[model samples]
Target: MNYALFIARKIYNGGDNTQKVSKPAINIATIGVAIGLAVMIISVCVVLGFKHSIRDKIVGFGSHITVANFLTLQSSEQYPIVINDSLTKELKTIPGVKHIQRYAYTQGILKTNSDFLGVVLKGVGPDFDSTFIHNNMVEGVIPRFSDTENQQNIVISKTIADKLKLKVGQRLFAYFINKQNVRTRKFTIAGIYSTNMKQFDAQVCFTDLYTAKKLNGWEADQYSGAEILVNDFLQLDPISYDVLSKVKNKVDHYGETYSSENIIEQNPQIFSWLDLMDMNVWIILALMIAVAGVTMISGLLIIILERTQMIGILKALGSRNKQIRHIFLWFATFIIGRGLIIGNIIGFGIIFLQKWTGLIKLDPQTYYVSTVPVEINISLIVALNLATLLICVLVLIAPSYLISHIHPAKSMHYE
Candidate 1:
């Protein structure tokens, strides 16, 4: 009993040959919409993927938040702090805290027969979360690193491994200079991992906390800092503030003041660059929507003009302008709906293919990822389709007004 929709469907089916002239225009409009939507979807997925991939890698290297001494923040040398059982228990009780692990850093040079490379030896205890490094392991396995035992085993990055011509199970000598005194230790490479992030891969290696602590001449109860993992990244800022308030004024046994910082604060340059990608995506979405709207307007105008005589007969039979406008809007909806279906198919197909096969590759040095990344968010895709259909119909409303201006008698003779 919906007369407007009924008439729109009849016109769309083109029972008569009169609609033939508008067929090509309609097809072009649908293609325009399809292409525009596909581009928008791909852009959104790729950008979101890039942001998440880079963010996770950075967090993997350190953690969501770090609580360290004030001196450690100012210099590479980690001033000792006491992260004893009492302090660990207090931090774990915080609402968002997931895990707390002890860590220390000491700088040294690994020497082989012909080459030497400087690296920061990251010391981790038995509680160290090796999930990230394990996933990225190219060869060998993570050793049992303990605070009480010195296994003399270390994990090196593929970048470092390649540069020093080193392999797992190879024994090498490392020299550490403390207050103008040179100390030497022999270590066996237990694992090799690669994150493809140059900053970490080139300069960081992992060892047992006891080894790192001994190099820094620290006691068993003292460490460089505590890395805190949170349940949700969205709560990082508030959790960091809560942690700072808890420990900021508290002095360690070594008389060191604690400072807390989140991953974003620790590496502002990389995060700022990621934030700028959002503006680029916004600009692309605007341009695509505009292109789709313009094409739909042109198609609507052509359909209206071609049906001039029908409009005249309907108006002569007492049809209102508003009713006539609804008919064309319904018709436009059909075209948009068809285009959206095709667009979704094409867009999702490309995304799945890329995600599974990683057919497209990028330079890790520049992009921080070896393959093009894509994220498929169902809610976002649905919103995009609904918004596209609504905007295209709204843009056609102005052109639909041309129907009211045409005199019935004149339009009947328009042919």
Candidate 2:
């Protein structure tokens, strides 16, 4: 009963070979669609993967949110704040708050006989979640920290290690200037990790909280700040606001006011750079879609012209212009559908290959990742396919009008 689709199928199946000229245009159009879609898919996946990887790396160094003293926020100095059990309990009550742990910082210098490096000794208590550091460890295991004892074990980054020619299990003396009094402590490196983030890797080293507290001359129950982890990063702002409400204007035992800031606020430069990648992806997508649509339109016009005799015969047999238009539209759909299938195969093949084998590599120093990252979002892929198909078909509608303008008598004579 659907004569348009029936005719479209017969023509698509090469029922008529007289339109040999159109074959080349059709193939070019399909190739154009396939390549454009593949490029779009690859662009989206790469950008998203880059964003996710970089965000995690930053968050791993500093948690989702930081609650520190107002003075500490102003200056990176470890101004003491008291995080008692009661305060911890109150913060844990806030929705989306996953974990809370005490942290402190002391700027010091690591010295060996061969080289010396400036570093920040980040002190974490027994409650510190070592998952992030553990995952990135290259040389040794993350040492266990205890609140009762000053464990002189520390974790250093590979960048610092390579720079200073230091290794895990090596004894290094760290010197800190406290109130113009130079103090020294000997620590054994327990682990070496690399996140490929030069900012953190070159400067930050992890040590037990007690050791950092002693270095800062702080008493028990005193810390520089608390790092808050949230269940979902999307809820970070709301959770940070909730935390600020609990601690804002409230003084610790030392009379220090608490200030809360999310990871994005702490590192604006890096996040802003990451945000720019989205713009790049949008531009790529727009250009690729335009290229594909143009090709499809051209191919549709050629196919309509080549089938002029068929159009005339159908019109003479009492077929309407609308019905004839549907015939070519259906034919265009078939071509577009075939291109989509090929594009999806090619796109996903590259994505999976890179993801599994890391066949393509990037400079860690610049990209913050060793290999090209790709994230396959099924929903996004499906949406892209649907949108591409719809847009190409819609663009071909005007060209399909050429079929309507073909006079039956004239088209019958169209060679």
Provide TM-scores for the models: 0.97, 0.96
Residue-by-residue lDDT tens digits, candidate 1, 68-172: 887887776578888888988999989999999999899999999999999999999899999999999999999989898789999999999999999999999
Spell out the clash pairs found in candidate 2: none
Q: Cα deviation of 85 in candidate 1 (Å)?
A: 2.1
Which candidate achieves the best TM-score against the true structure? 1
Q: Each model's C-alpha lDDT?
A: 0.91, 0.89
Task: Give lDDT tens digits, candidate 2, residues 127-195.
Answer: 999889999999998988866677789899999999999888899899998885999999999999999
Where is model 1 more than 4 Å wrong at Cα?
16-18
Write down the lDDT that model 1 would get. Answer: 0.91
List, in order, the clash count of every candidate structure.
0, 0
